[model samples]
Target chain A: MKYSILASTLLLAGGVAVLSGCSQVQEPAGICNMSAIAAQRQLAAAPSRVQGGESPLLEMPLNSVSITDYSVINKLYVRTVNARRTPTGTVEVYAQIINCTDFPLNAEARTQFYDAGQAPSEPISAWKRFNLPARTSNTYQTQSIGTQSAAFYMVELRETK
Target chain B: MRRARALPLLVLASAFSLSACQTVQNTAGTPTQYLDPGSSGVVRGVGIEGQDIRSMSDEMMRDLLTVPALANASISPNVIVDAEYFQNESSSRINKNIITDRLRVDLNRASRGRMQFVGRQYADMVQSERNLNQAGVVSGGTIARTAGQLAGDYRLGGRITSIDARDPRSGMIERTHQITFEMVNLQNGQIIWSNYYDLRKAAQDDIIYR
Candidate 1:
């Protein structure tokens, strides 16, 4: 009776392990925490929230709007960013992202240009990818394709697989 | 009674096997998903892929639109994208037309009247139609006709070239492709704006590019 019970217990344990393995996504050790990356990305995109001072999104009220991002990239911090209206009247954006983690992270971001009236431009910008070295800063930039049509802009960032 | 008892056991075995079988003749499984063409393609080879084409064209278009002269010029620049001037000097077999077409089409759509595309290659058909209309054989086009076709202010052309290296031991091959784009002033024959995009990729040369 004990032998049969032991065999049945072993079988149950193996099945449990297999089931767990199937559901869990395998990522490199020590860098799999997506929540931390999400935080950083959100922080990098926070500059769009600043109203009236420097950002080209002149239509939005100060401190009332923030760039929306993937929930997990909230940790990506913005070192410095410059946003302005160019000679062509389109919004131009340049941003520096600081990676606080111990390992390199591959990330992608895209910006959507909107008219002052909060209307989104047709066909969102392509997702541009960049590599951030551990404890280093990476720069990303984009210009609106439509000249007079772009007044306000919002950027989204996420960790790329 | 004996036969009845054997029949139940046989039925039980068949039912158990059917329930446990992994392969079924006709049943629904996972529905297929799609991949973005700009980044990925159905075919994978040692040579260039869809991502390269998309990235190069996108970069070229972005840079081309940002040029100040195109808009600042006194007259709206008439742009032409002809295969004759755009040469493919690379070792790989690629459809160079795809690159030029994407750039021209996207730029034309987004330029907002700042630039105009001249279909010079289709001039023969246009000329033929013009003659027919002027001769009163056919009704004239809705727009008024000019004495002659408009000349292009700027001509667009480029070249696709490559450099390659190989490791004999590991049989790894690396190739770097350089795609250069330029807009030249039609009258002065001077290059107004020039840009080059290059990428180096290494992979085992197991499959052919074509």
Candidate 2:
């Protein structure tokens, strides 16, 4: 009888110990919080204003010479070309224009070639304007304007005000 | 005598086992923390903290520019916005009406618009209209029409949403919240512009205790 009781008690104690050990082992792992970083990102992504007044030109009326329904003649284009004689052979020029506000633009704006002193040189009427409707956009080829001339050249909007 | 002694021993063992079970149950249960009203700089969760009308409005105003659609368009003249619909989500503790008020202020500032509050007289008008409809005295559609007549060109409407979840294995908690604002052209029922802002926060469960 004593041996039987001893054996049963030993078995119960061993089972209890095993269960307790398992429970301890199953305890949840620690967690690392990342809430702060998320909050920071949100704050950074938020749109914010830098201090400045509105542009003055936005309030002014757009100048128009004629009310003829015009299309956008040409969109802006820029390119570089090589000068034959000069060591600094490369020159760059940008050209573009809106054809008409009303009709679709047909011809691309031409690069009216000019000399160093703003005089007409090569009439590369080779540039053609394209049709662009009102409130629309168009693109044209970039021309190398002052490649060979040793004199400096500049491009400007030519339509008379 | 031997049998009697073994019975007492078995009872004691059973008692020990029962106590151990109770301890495990108590330890495994979830624990919660409450906000201390007196605590300072304890950043409240999205909707728990009292609404900061001024700050919220300012933030909303600034975000208006970030909308890609508006970037290239000509800037609009500032207009005034009155509160349309501002309420807290069901789960939030914050007062939703206060949020709406703040939004009005914020949008006004951001868009350079003004805000005009509907006074007590208008409130009475709305209440009377509600009562009339409830009593079957007037058509429900008339209420909106009457309100619009009193109000102006645009109506601002918005909603807020939020989610909170905790991961048991990682002991990580994440909270996400968003607000969407829309401007409706009342006459045409067209949505002229809409903006949305989302905020997310995550912290380890342990840090929550800290």
Q: What's the C-alpha lDDT at position A121 in model 1?
A: 69
Interface RMSD of candidate number 2: 25.5
Q: Which stretches of candidate 2 lie over 4 Å from their true place?
A: A1-161, B1-40, B46-55, B63-84, B106-121, B125-149, B169-171, B204-210
In candidate 1, what are the lDDT values of residues B97-136, reduced to their tens digit?
7787877877787776878888887899989998898899
lDDT (tens digit, per residue) of candidate 1 on A1-161: 99999999999999999999899976432343456534543222223446754554333232112334543244456556667765655557878876666677766666777776767864566666678877677887777777777776766666753
**iRMSD computed for candidate 1:** 2.3
Residue A6 in candidate 2, Cα distance off native in Å: 84
Model 2's CAPRI class is incorrect
Q: How large is the C-alpha RMSD of every model relative to the true structure?
A: 14.7, 30.5
| Candidate 2 lDDT tens digits, B79-197 | 33544454446344555556566555444433322233333326677778677776889774832444332454455677777898888888776777676777666677777677655
DockQ of candidate 2 against the true complex: 0.01
- The DockQ-derived docking category for candidate 1 is incorrect
Residues A42-142, candidate 2: write the lDDT tens digits: 11121123345433322111111111222211221122222222212323333333332334333323334445643554433222223445534444332
